[model samples]
Target: MTRITDTRDGPAEGARPGALPVAGLLLAAGGGRRLGGRPKALLGHLGRPLVEFAAGVLRDGGCVPRYVVLGARAADVRNRAELPGCVLVDNPGWADGMGSSLRAGLAALAATDAPAVLVTLVDQPRVGAAAVARLLAAHRAGAGLAAAAYGGERGHPVLFAREHWEGVALSAVGDRGARAYLRAHAGAVALVECGDVAAPDDVDTPEDLRLLD
Candidate 1:
């Protein structure tokens, strides 16, 4: 899971008010042990790297200045991933788990004037710009936490409210990311039904990629 929140009121000066302060946090730190140590983001999908597709979705959704958190094989992924305006962040503690990457991404977002963030994974090719926009709109419409749900299962690219930024930051430190944190604050979360079967599909192994093909 990835933790992204709104921080439009951050210390950063010159941030636009009511502009839906949002950032795109792309988590590219997975080791991909399931794929025999391959960098999943670098994997090809229809002639484009997985990371590119994910970034394109965020970009199309109007997510400004996306930030990608890298871990193992960071250099290779960075060089191969073709995200024109994305900012890369190296997460040295990514070995700990997805939580570490989330924290690192959040730390970088905190510096920006963005009040909300849309966090997604590089391996989830099924999640598109429409899904991201839906979640963002829901969050801005007063939901503290807005996430896409497929077949009743809550999935990635969750949009978090700025009020919960600190909790998300603290939760994303160990092996777990924001699962427990979101669960504990269930009252603040609103689930948006994606209905699309592709929304929950993620490429974690060669077979998963083949399925997409």
Candidate 2:
């Protein structure tokens, strides 16, 4: 069973008055098999674990009661990462892939009052607070599904309204993680251009670690 540790209650304190309460869900459970068994969440960046930086991006982007899904070395991440005010979700099936972490995150957030959730990858360090704010703005502007776009192509930090949660969770299998759902409803997704303010390059291989530099 997944253990969802709720660190806070009530509507999102980070959201502005009369604004839609949106929760930020960070998927940081990858066991970097391509990086010699190291967990991505525990990867060092900016003098702290990568998970810490990613979680901070969510908080700074104005998301309250944030949720982080941990799987690979869950205990180690909890011990090493300083994620105050964020709900830590344990996803035992994380080895299964991103979908498991997504499902775990959505399940934990199901108990919240947030009308939407902004899903971000822990590996995407370059997708900063600006990109997140853009997606949140799209949601506030009446878009049900919104995603960051770079050079006209859609990318991460996707915002999903409550109505799409069930479908996304159902289609979420393996590493797909809403990819299929987003594709199925492409016409409705609001693509917010974030190329100027941020980048979407993800940290994966040894060569990609340079992105963190």
Candidate 3:
């Protein structure tokens, strides 16, 4: 587990000083109604659980102290997806919607000293570490907010600069996630074209999982 620190002292030897300090927050609080009440993050993909795969991607991309937001079947999901270095946080308000989970994640990120946060969903099993690294690299290059776009459709694992933390923290609970906020602050956004549509392929139903298989 790599420790997150203030990089201002200058990167170690050959490391770059401007490398953005970013933490990853995985939103796994969904109840999985479409999947028969199962925790989507706990669902298996090949030989690994979904959430574990997502965590692996973030970790490999150099995102430290990853936080997982659990809700409905928190225990079962947490027990089944025992990812190392992940901090599990329960969202009692998950019933409210994705907005609640987003807020909960933001609150957790707020507690950390990281200068930025990359938010992603647990259901998107195919979003790999390289994709996350791309977003982080773009953010470090001066983008206030960096996002992955597939075929021109912007999607998850959005990286937010500490400057926009307050906006995300104060978001209301509803079906819409951070689209509105991102749209309102379009001037500061740095859209990275991943050229892969699978980045936004979330397993919302059993059929979706089947498609991945």
Error of 2 at 3 (Å): 1.2
lDDT of 1 by residue, 1-213 (tens): 333333233332323555645788888888888989877777787787777888788878767658888888877876676666677788887788999888888888787777788888888887888888888788778787877888877888788766777899887757678888888887777888886634677788768977443
Tens-place lDDT digits, model 2, residues 34-100: 9888899999999899999999999988786699999999999988889888899999999999999
Candidate 2 residue spans exceeding 4 A from truth: 9-20
Model 1 lDDT at residue 145: 88
Mark the 10 consecutive residues where model 3 has the least summed lDDT: 1-10
State, as a TM-score between 0 and 1, how close model 3 is to the true structure: 0.87
Better of 2 and 3 by lDDT: 2
Off by over 4 Å in 1: 1-20
Candidate 3 error regions (>4 Å):
1-20
Report residue 58 deviation for candidate 3 (angstroms): 0.7
Candidate maximizing TM-score: 2
